[model samples]
Target chain A: MNHPPTTATLLALLATLACNVDRKQDDVPATDPPTPHVALLTSGPVSDAGWHAGAYEGLQLIGDSLGFEVSHQQTRTPAEFDEAFISYAEDGYGLIFGHGFEYQDAASRAGEQYPDVTFVVSGGSRPSANVVPLLFHLNEASYLAGMAAGAVTAAGIVGMVGGVEIPTAKGTFVAFEAGVKAVRADAAVLETFTGDWYDPSAAKEAAAAQLRQGADVLIHNLDAASFGFFQAVREAREGGSEAWAFGMNRDQNDVAPDVIVGSAVINIPAMFLRTATAWRDGTLGGVAEYAGLRVGAVEFVPNPAQEGVIPPEALARIDEARQAIIAGELEVPRIEYLEPEDDDPPSP
Target chain B: MNRTLTPVLTATAALAATLAVAAALLALGGHSPGAVFAALLRGAFGTWDRFFSFTLVRATPLLLTGLAVALAFKARVWNIGAEGQLHAGALAGVAVAILLPVHSPLLVLPATLAAAAAAGALWAAVPAAMKTRMGVGEVITTLLMNFVAVFLAQFLVQGPLQEPRGVFNQTDEIPLAARLPALLPDTRLHLGFLLGIVIAVALWLYLTRTPGGFRLRAVGASPRAAEVSGRFRAGPVVWLAFLTSGAIAGLAGWIQVAGVTHRMYEGLSPGWGYTAIAVALLARLNPLAVVVTAIVFGALSAGGGAMQREAGVPEVWVRGIEALVILAVLTVDRSWQVLAGGGSRD
Candidate 1:
């Protein structure tokens, strides 16, 4: 009896077809003599001016400081993640930064294939021998920002707008909520997750919803969506309302100098350079790199334009909390979203 | 021989033209064209492991979606909502995977797939009913439904179907029982690829051998002529095409989730549904041909990543090259027809 070709046979034929083509070996050496090549893969465009921009700057900083050949690509989907990792590793890129938690799975897979290449994922949930999660503990700074929001809210109401309630984002809000309550015990807090990372309209609508509920101070953990939050707050103040916003992730105070009180920032460039240095020195990887206020990586930077807007006591208390957090006297709230394999559902 | 060779010749012309144009662009952008091309080829098929794991694994969904689009276009039904139908199926399949009481792989897998297909068909039925009853166009209806489906998926991941912790907007992974087994011993390629091939072969046989398929094609070629000459009803045939296309697309969604992703998340597709149109059209709406065309697209996508990684080419440029190739394909195919016409006249 004649049988049709099975998938196994067909796949074999496809590979054979590919194999038949004459191939040229890569003549370019994997790494140049003096410096190793580095790359960054972002899920969003670098022009996003938030998450992706910060990473792009880090890539540039690494290149400028280390004299390495640096490049950046805005990858859209998970399928591209493996390809980017494998390609970079094959080309002798010593370090590749996938600037989001989403890169963890693909990074680990590629890390296994190329043992020498170091893959660093920002806000990543997992860590491997070669794949290291560069955890930016911004929640500690958000806690301080929450204290500032609590101190300055004229209406005694504050709002927290977020993009996708991932554990990292949630941890910031959780710490912020705790910090707000600590400063103003009677302050009413409102929370909304826009369920997006880059939708400005949705973020604007969410901020507006919180403003309409009488939130005089707003803070957000959105990426490019942060623009909408600031816009909504600025419009609220222009419309004769007493509303202000704190910027989250990177120093976004200059983005909206008039309305932004302060920024809870993660100094991503410094972290990338430090990580790259460690890799160069053969002392990086195999564990999570927790960058927080202690390492001078995360901090709450006050807006220069609105210098005196925060009362002296609030600023002093914020400084105190910062010291306490660094000294282990104050413990900020955090969420361990990363799971071990066994935590997943059991096999049938 | 002349008839069979025409498509091959046109395809070859399209590929060559695309490469020439792309090489110029790459050179203009300060990249070595030879290096980039070599990187692209190696990325797609450099190793047996890459071919099965990267190329074929990526091709699986494209093949299924291409077949769906080809089947519908064969009957002159424009189903832009394959994206929405796919999402509908994924949502339903995941819901069943999580909520169903059955534990056996045999029972659970089939039931989940059935639910996905039904959900996909139901999603398509909305546009089909609107087109048949109100005489509204299916193109706009189907396209609009995609947005609704995406929003619905977003809501499900965030709200009711969310993972227990509720930290992120994604569903929990389905049980091991529901997952499609790996086709290769140590590769990521799964049973879904085989399923896609089987479906393509079956569809080709149905389109060529079945009476219903003939009636559908007749309606597509000319509805009025079909009704007068062949005594075929266009309405039923169109509805059949719409629903069947939706069913196939829905299965694609489920297979992707069950075979690869193992969970439902936003942006799981990365616009595979929209890409299927080009895949189908490039194959001239032939199901068997879609299999080949889909693999070509799959290789392009897989290679695009490698180009970015190996040649330091930006992803946007790789995407630009891909679009250029598709454009070249359509143009060359059209020009080949004119050339053939000139040859016939001579």
Candidate 2:
């Protein structure tokens, strides 16, 4: 019958909690060998299983291998970007990884302010003395996947379903087209962008439209929505047509073992570890870091379930092209518009 | 109890309850509740720069949208489409900035804002018409219209309104003329925040001073009573409230674009419209109190980043606190109503 007592108890608890916040506590240092602290900023949840997830895994790997204290935050808006960078830098984090191109400008601003802290932006275009872009050459692997698709398809037509028509996305499709034509000279290429990154229904509809246009093989540059592309191909196969799908970003071959031919993967965790180690060694930042087939960062992972689906001759060509790219004899087509450090003088 | 003091006491109680619950939850998750709160405070208001640049910057959109929702709810017009109307306003404002030849701030700013307001009113017209003419619930209609607005924005950014080079899935930045000047000399605090405060004051006066405002409140209190006793039709008042609410929400969108982001993109809003409901209800739908309530929510959002960086507290925990605040406020408000004889029958 006495509500006042409950309210009074709550107020007393809050007063104690407030006092506790002001009391100084012993610092429990979490690093050994006095390693610099590292952190990561992502725009989406790490459980996304694709872009954000890969970056999260990379942050964990860096922490484990380098013995650096690491933390991560999922930022929501551009307004939050600067605050996150400033917080990390001010808190003595020596290295911060922003896992998207969107972080380029904020990273640049933070890099200028915090000269001692290194900022690495994945899929970023701009570079600076303290800000580095981790150029993910997934397009190179996508081209190889295109070669595999060209060899596997019997109808001499291929399709690509993309989340958005950003330059980086279009670059993959462009390279994919060139690779397909390299294998099957007369093959037709159809491209559709769903304009959505996570909508399965829209991706499926776009994929189905491509299938109706005589494209028997489809590759999607979508992240979590690739399942819809695979589903469309599966439905087409159920309706008495032969259709296949290729995965991009992380290895998603097992997502639909029967329909997915292969995956174009960027070994994000390995790349993070290598970059963090390089930073510790004073060899990272001050320029863009390029990771491609040469560095074993990107690869066209063949699905064992789809073995023999792609002709061995096409696989041989893909392997030769991969080696050629590594040996500096072949160059993959890429869109390079995100240069945040372009204004700076070229570093040796 | 003094009537004017009741809402303040209720809000304070609700806030205390939320903090207690949040503290318990943080402790359960193996984090120091005190440390998390300290980090949040430092992040939101530790320094003057942090308070003005971070917390107030985040509060700008919330203030406008909160006032918009509070105004609409005052007349009992359930407008859940503020999100959609915001997008409509932003899209129209950005379109004018990109397509129009106006180059001076004097010319471009007003033109763009006008276009935004008109577009927002247009977006609300559909739902308002449905409610007025066809007797459809504005709740369902407004909510569904949000989907249309979101999709339209996505389509435009990806296709026609995409950056001139067609490289990114965003519109070109608004011209300098159309952009809002900074209210502070060296901070991100823009003129839009001042505009929001001015609008809130104006809305308070309009609601308290005008005969039209009295009629709107009467219609909201009892449509039959207003129509018979006040000798005025409730339908026109409802329509007026709905349109005005959409216009205010529209201004929020364009202000965000012109003030902060500088361009429209897919994730332009982090659900500020939806969050504004909690803000409005917490203020008890008072336009003047909405400013303070919006800042409280803004501090939470701005501090969430600091929690992750300084205390290693996850964003999910901050989100849990936000949800708990909304729940606690609703409960406290409901308890007051019950104590006031509304729930005595039960």
Candidate 3:
């Protein structure tokens, strides 16, 4: 009968004891200031071996090359976003990267509060004095990969499997369709979005449906679901149909080497390194940082083992287009999500 | 005298044993257990700011939902649809807050929260009716309703309730008038925490002091006995538990949006409805104890993030440790009941 009250008291007492222990530990002051700390916050686990993993790699690259202390926290909820940002900033982290577009609002709020800390968000739309959006023009690389798909497809049909119909994902498909038409004016392109980023079964089902409709070359912008897309294409090949797949996000060319013609790669580690170095030199501007074919951050990397998979003529054309994009001669189509800024508005 | 002391000692031993196992596991993973535990404590209770801003804010939702679960379980209603009820409430709350034209705080806040509670009650009403009228098992129906609620939320956010920009898969922020007022200045803690505490005390009083509460508890203890001895049908009590539980859970969802996020988005709950089951069980279905248990869980959640940041432990491992703690506590509670010569309370 009295157990519940006693148990509650005991639990409360234990919590208090733990708090006192933490306070005692905090009493000891730091003898020396630690090195400049850089932190990364991701919404998903880094073990996904794709988008999140790439960001984690970039964090490690900054730590290894720039000699900065590094930390990473996989935040699960939006409520944790502000907490993580404040915690890192309070601990003297000079630069903190919120690794997805969802971090944009939180980063904007945190940036205003912690003016000294530089907050970078990938695929972010909002940009403030300290909140820089790391926009990746992966559509440019997707266009090149589309050109390769158009060349490699003997069936005169290509497919694009994507996760989510967001502007960014749709932009890649738009550029990819244009790329295919650029190479083959009459080529039929198929596109499907599974509405989920990590459902391999849905991606595979979409891939299979595309393959059934005579798409021999396929490209996918999915995370863990890309495995299902690749599996579908491999199954098509295994069934004695000529099939090939292109990888998206990071250098996934090695993932399905036997069937992969190339991969539209994002050099995330290099971008993180450059961003960190810029932050150190005080050259990281408030404007959204654009990294694309021009900056060598985005590329269409053809598989080394499948050197001759793409027609030789198509390879030359891809190289030409790459150079044109880098030289600002050819424009790859994209959806602009960032609003135009009027002036350097002062902070409220 | 010895019996009262034995249960306390057993609970303490179980907790110590769980910590030892957790420490050993951390050491095996090449992390200093002391540093990790210290980091967790500092993250959760390191300062008043951290506790109020992070831990309490995180606990608000869990506290409400835990109370909801406890209330339902107390009446032996077996209502497992709190998750769906939460989603339904959130969607309804957001709809009212955004669409309602009255900009006054008095009109909008209460109306929005009332709509949320009604929507939640309506959601649970489906399963409650099924169980009462059709003699269907509520376990399956309630659980399945969760999926329906989630999908409905997704559709609404993507379609009807999508922001005017139509770029992100979320609703526009609720107006300032509809937002929960801040309870603590300069902290994210909002009126929701106080609301939860108030609801807990009210629920505790209702469950212990009211005649209706006695009838509900009697039916929960033994429906046949209640029918014969208490002379009351259990059906009405079950319905009451279902609607009340759903209403509280619904409040948890909308309060989270009003107080913390200020915007409705997909994945807002982070499985808090499901975790409420653990919270309710850990509290032994006591309304007041649920408040304490919810904070403990909130600390674990807040500290789990720190374990990743400061301790360098991965999230998967932190979750494993959380599961271990829950298991240990339940096991100890079960053993205490057995030692007390109480054969199956359920």
Which is superior by DockQ, 2 or 3? 2
Q: Candidates' lDDT values, in order? A: 0.84, 0.84, 0.87
| Candidate 1 stretches greater than 4 Å from native | A1-26, A30-39, A63-73, A86-96, A108-119, A128-131, A340-348, B1-5, B101-103, B342-346
**On DockQ, who's better, 1 or 2?**
2
Chain B alone vs. reference chain B, TM-score for every model? 0.96, 0.95, 0.95
Model 2 clash pairs? A125-A338, A125-A339, A126-A338, A126-A339, A126-A340, A127-A341
lDDT by residue (A235-320, candidate 2, tens digit) is 99999988888888889988899888899888999999989999999999778998888898999999999898888888899999
**lDDT measured at residue A152 in model 3 versus the true structure, 0 to 100:** 88
Q: What DockQ does candidate 3 score?
A: 0.38
- Order candidates by DockQ, high to low: 2, 3, 1
* iRMSD values, candidates in order: 9.5, 6.3, 4.9
Indicate which candidate wins on TM-score.
Answer: 3
Put down candidate 1 lDDT per residue, B27-103, tens digits, no spaces.
99999877787777887887887788778888988899898998988888899988999999999999999999889
Better of 2 and 3 by TM-score: 3
lDDT tens readout by residue for model 3, A115-145: 9899999998888789999998999999999
